[model samples]
Target: MGILTDTTHLHITTWVVAVILFLVAAFMQRDSKGRKIVHMVLRLFYVLIIITGLALFIEWSSSDPMTYGIKFLLGLLTIGMMEMVLIRSKKQKPVTMFWALFVLFLLATMFIGFMLPVGLDFF
Candidate 1:
């Protein structure tokens, strides 16, 4: 419990980094080698984000399972939307819808995360 006692910073850091990487990868030329590298790095951040998020959830969710559960699901949906947007963009398909959903879900997830007991309480 010691190491995992407070994973909030790690979780938030992962999300921030993942978002930046995703944006960078998404805007790069589809066939560029640098885009491929950034995409791979973004994938790694995805894994790190999931791991840190799960750690925080497991550590603090007992206090309010329902809200935490919703936040968790929203987080997953946000991640899925991000990946879908990137994939569709790379395939030269229309990504406007996925981009919209990604923004929606990401904002919702952030709101919930901030409202949680262990969260920033900014909202």
Candidate 2:
């Protein structure tokens, strides 16, 4: 397959890993060691997601400055909210709001991808 197709596949796989990590980090109530391990794994997954996402973005439509700019801003906001959720207070409400924002951004990204003729030209 082409590089774009391969990259798309990898991107989807990385997202799946990210989702698993999110669930583990959000729901798992284990010992300190286990929690640490989960946190480490989630951090690594986040890095991979960012890297692959950038690669995919470059491959898809680097020619469109506006789309790229929007994507970059949204990505930064998503990551920032996730970091806040992880490191801010132990309070549940703020954490829930962060996760909710993360999910909303994720869904927004998917919707944009589906509706726009940009990434992968899949539609």
Please tell me which predicted candidate would have the highest TM-score against the true structure.
1
Model 2 lDDT tens row, 59-118: 665567567657656765666676666654334445778878988887776656554444
Q: Write the per-residue lDDT of candidate 1 for residues 52-115, one digit (tens) a residue.
A: 7888888889999989899999999999998998888888999999999999999999999999
Error of model 1, residue 24, in angstroms: 0.5
Error of 1 at 78 (Å): 0.9
Tell me how far the alpha carbon of residue 82 in candidate 2 is from the true structure, in angstroms, after superposition: 2.6
- TM-scores for all candidates: the values are 0.95, 0.73
lDDT of 1 at 8: 77
In model 2, the worst 10-residue window by lDDT is 85-94
Instruction: After superposing candidate 2 on the true structure, give the runs of residues whose Cα lies further than 4 Å from its correct spot.
Output: 1-6, 89-93, 116-123
> Who wins the lDDT comparison?
1
